[model samples]
Target: MGDFRRSRLSSTPVVGRVVEWKKTHGWIEPECTIDHPEMAKHQGHIFVHGEDLVPKWRNLVAGAMVEFFLYYDGQGLGAEECTSRKVLRVTLPWKHAKEMFGESGEKLADFEQQTHVTIRAYQWCQPDGNNSDLPFLLFEIWGRPQAVVESIGALAARREQDGNAAEDTLCVNLLLPESRMWKVDLMQLQHYCSLEVSSSITITDPMPCRTLTIQAPLPHFRSSLHALIAQAACVGNLW
Candidate 1:
């Protein structure tokens, strides 16, 4: 049997928005509530130190998005391995498009028209040390066209009408490299799998990138992920 010791801290990173930042320390309002029972004892904000910031930034502006692993040092919940999420507009290439939206068939044409999609990119900091100049890598991309959303909504409604549970989630897929997969501990991944934010991950066959599909809750997805799409859409409207 595998070792089943589960740490109270989070192994996978969670998304959050910065609440405030002092010179040395700050607080972040997590996108989802922390599930640990001990979390009720303190305010919901996650403590973050300046040193923990990836690339070692001095101050984080309020409302800036970030991702980090959660930790509790017997005192309070804190954030570590923090990194800022940079949102940008990206046009997916045909090969990439085939992988993500191939199921859409003729609808792929519609997706092509809406090529300028919003994605949250993160700095690829080195494990040994931080390098401020490293280019940002795309972490999360929203490619769901309006037609797809309507289709999903209809399917959900039908399920609810049939007395089945409604599926209210947006899939957040990750494509991770096979070489790095060995370094990740399956036990730790299993532990975090119970959380709503990390539950939808599915590891498939060996691929060039780290990929998993996560069924993110619709409400949280709207507030965090879809908000970027809305902002990008507004910008497009201005032009």
Candidate 2:
């Protein structure tokens, strides 16, 4: 299950067309003018203009019905518009998602911290606008979504002292697709079932937040691990 806190606060799916793209917005890249009916129906829904930090997204055209996720921050305004926040992910057509997010395509893993992986799509897009340059006609690779509904308490704890297996006193857990996992040579447990490693002698420390994406792995488990390891070094029984 996805984290209830994360799902409720962030990762709200919004559907709308790129109504406009004004060059006058700025220099780095144009501002996305998304028109979602949810805003009108909800009354106080704010017209959000999100930024696409992905340089390749420069080809996005107006009038394209795109699926995207919004970041959340409690505010007095009816609908929060985070100019600083970009789309958590954009869902495109299935065939299109493969071409775009597939290995040879956009390869979003190279950029974003992919997690809470999912596949979603809308029926169709209006027959107007220049959506040909768009990767998928009706599908999107919903890459980043939410944190896993898990906690440190849910994870089994263990201690290690020597050998490469026990080398990591603690580590952040990350789940990655087999395909992307192949390209990345980071040290990972071969068989991690039930959040447990398959054959790793090392005791895996699942990260506090269970993220689904393969994104880049975190170096250290957490700062707390440093102190814990330091004290454990002397006593060897603090855990």
Q: Could you give me the TM-score of model 1 versus the true structure? A: 0.36
Give the worst 10-residue stretch by lDDT in candidate 1: 230-239
Alpha-carbon TM-score of each model against the true structure? 0.36, 0.23
lDDT top scorer: 1
lDDT of 2 by residue, 35-108 (tens): 43332342433333333323322433442333344432232111122212111112233564455456444564
Report lDDT (CA) for all predictions.
Answer: 0.48, 0.29
- Number of clashing pairs per prediction, in order: 11, 10
lDDT per residue (tens digit) for residues 86-140 in model 1? 4322223334434545533344344433542223333345567775442222333
What does candidate 2 score on TM? 0.23
**lDDT value, candidate 1, whole model:** 0.48
Best candidate according to TM-score: 1
